[model samples]
Target: MAEIRLAIVGLGKIAHDQHLPAVAATPGISVAAVASRNATLDGVPCFLTIEALLASGVEVDAVALCTPPMGRHRLAAAALRAGKHVLLEKPPGASVAEIAPLEALARDRGLTLFATWHSRFAPAVEPARALLAEAEIRSVRVNWKEDVRHWHPGQEWIWQPGGLGVFDPGINALSIVTRILPRPLFVTEAVLEFPGNRATPIAASLRLGDAAGLEVAVEFDWRQTGPQSWDIHVDTADGALVLSGGGRHLSRDGAILHDAPEREYTEIYHRFVALIGAGASEVDLAPLVHVADAFMLGERRVVAEFHW
Candidate 1:
């Protein structure tokens, strides 16, 4: 197929900061149209909604759904029914169940569906997987903390129901964990701290374990103040493997290993292109499942009301 004419739905910060740049850098794929409620881009047909964009007679072959997870399934289903391939942003849907029907729809239509976990494309991720494949896994630790003001700012949907709040970023860590590990991990227990004023938790701690007794400790906090921390440290029989700077840096036993420039979204689009070429779909719900499990098994505590 020729360069895929892609439409990006939702003009949030992530759309401009990540998807726009990634699509520009990747070959064999270019953004041809956009659907956003409150934003516009130069040289592209912009619509107020995805439905309007789809009906606008724009020559779009695929769409990247970057909207908040709450109602994305409707858009994905519409795109699939319209015979267009779809690329879903992280944490594909509001709930784990919303993805299966869309997956079936894509399969029925023979169109590609990608539930993207962009963090899995981090420079160190594949290499980390490769290394952990041969080593005896011991334990995993994740400390993903970032200030909402710095990252999300006034994004109110994030604090609303199904926005995933802290898990919005925490799911990225779960993505990397599910990718690198050799086996399935389940949430054993969790403690969630929800602000009295918000509908979601601002901080969370979770304990996870595999069938083989390997343990993983997770800490996700949107209330972090200083230099943000996005790190995962794993202890093996040989020592420890660390992925810091949000999987941009990798170190083994205090030795620098893979520290490549981060182009995670670029890699995502590259994989999306390949999937479309092959007429295949990539929808892995392991990360979202962990988040779901965390919520299901967590202890909720009401805290002070969060402002801004």
Candidate 2:
């Protein structure tokens, strides 16, 4: 098969750090151009907007969107309408209602639309999944706490109304949780703690359950001071299972079970190439759906201000 000429939209930190490098390293892929409002690539073609890029007649097979979740639907819709496959960054869209339209557009155009979740491609995650499949899960707990200033820095959009705030990282946990568990889960109750000055929450606690009465509680806080934790612990009939280091390591019975270097973006690129080659679309919004449900049904409380 011929190489897929790809263009990247929204050249932000994720594009520079993850997508760019991964595209460069992957086979059967070439980044022909980049679209960003405030940045430009040295050698590759750059455009200020997606419409401008399409209007310029830059022939490319696919476009990867790395924009914030707020206004991504229109860009994605346009890309699909223009007959270009789209690879959306995680949290696909701002709301649950937005995803169906994009999916419909992609189907109407017969183009591949991939909503990438790089975290699910983590090495240890599948291994952990295999171990947990047979065990009778008794309970599950997730502690995903980090210092937002250290992680997100001065990114102001994260606190905006549709930006997802702490869930910007929390969804990664949800993705893994949804994958590893044996059955589907739904949010029962949730509490969102928002900064007095922001529209998004700074912290969230959710209670999730399955039909079998399994209990899973998730806690996300963007105010942790030191030693950030991205840990998920599940207790089952076969001792206890621990997936730590953002699903890069696994431990059980106080012993390390599995560990490997992270190649999440590499795997994501491989999958993208394969999906494009086979004319397949991969867009799973269950994680984001749960987030939206939490937001709609959660009780909100005002908290202290957050300043970087």
Candidate 3:
């Protein structure tokens, strides 16, 4: 197949830091244009909005949406209607209800719609999955804490209604968990700590379990000071497995099982290409469902106000 001429929407931090570089590195993919209100790429046609890019007729075969979840549905629907393949960043939409119709629309139009969970592509994720496939899981624990000041800086939208706050990073951990576990896990109880002035939570503690009563604990916090941590520990009948560095490192019983450089976005593009070739759409809402469940069953506690 010819190179996929892709247009990138919402050229913000993730787009500049990961998407653009990944697209450049992946074969059979080319950056045809870019659409963003305040950002643009050098050497590519830039537009203020997706509608403007579609109207300008830049001839794009696909579009990657890096926009916030609030307005993602509208943009994705319009792209599908326009007959272009679509790739959505994690946490596909603000609400779980919005995803089903988009999947149906893409299927009806025979266009590829990839709801990408980039962290699931971590090098150690599959290895961990394979290891757990044989071992009987007794319990699970997830600790995903990071400093918002260091990662998000002055990105104010994160504290807004649809920003997802700490969940913006928490969902990555959930994605990996959903992928590695043999059975589905559901949120049984949750506590979300919201800043007094913010619409979203700054920290959350969750209790989850599977059908067989297997226990799982998850903690997400944005108040870490010194060293940021993204780790998942799984205890099994055989031994304990640890996935540290946000799924980049996997160890068990004091021995390193898998550790390698991160190329998650690069692998994401590869999957997008394959999905487009197969004329299929991959949209798994399990991870997002877990988030929605947490919000529904969680108790809200107002914490001290935060300011950047």
TM-scores of all predicted structures: 0.99, 0.98, 0.99
RMSD per candidate (Å) reads 0.8, 0.9, 0.7
Stretches of candidate 3 exceeding 4 Å from the true structure: none
Q: State the lDDT of candidate 1 residue by residue for 218-297, as single tens digits.
A: 99999899899999999999889999999999999999999999999999999999999999999999999999999999
lDDT per residue (tens digit) for residues 1-308 in model 3: 88999999999999999999999999999899999999988999999999999999789999999998999999999999999999999889989999999999999999999999999999999999999887789999999999999999999988998889999999999999999999899999999999999999999999999998999999999999899989999998888999999999999987999999999999999999999998888999999999999999999999999998
Q: Candidate 2, residues 24-58: lDDT per residue as tens digits?
A: 89999999988899999998889999999999988
Error of model 2, residue 26, in angstroms: 0.7
lDDT of 1 at 230: 98
Segments in model 1 whose C-alpha atoms lie over 4 Å from true places: none
- Candidate 1 clashes between residue pairs 3 or more apart in a chain or in different chains: none
> In lDDT terms, how accurate is model 2?
0.92
Candidate 2 deviant stretches above 4 angstroms = none
Relative to the true structure, candidate 2 reaches a TM of 0.98
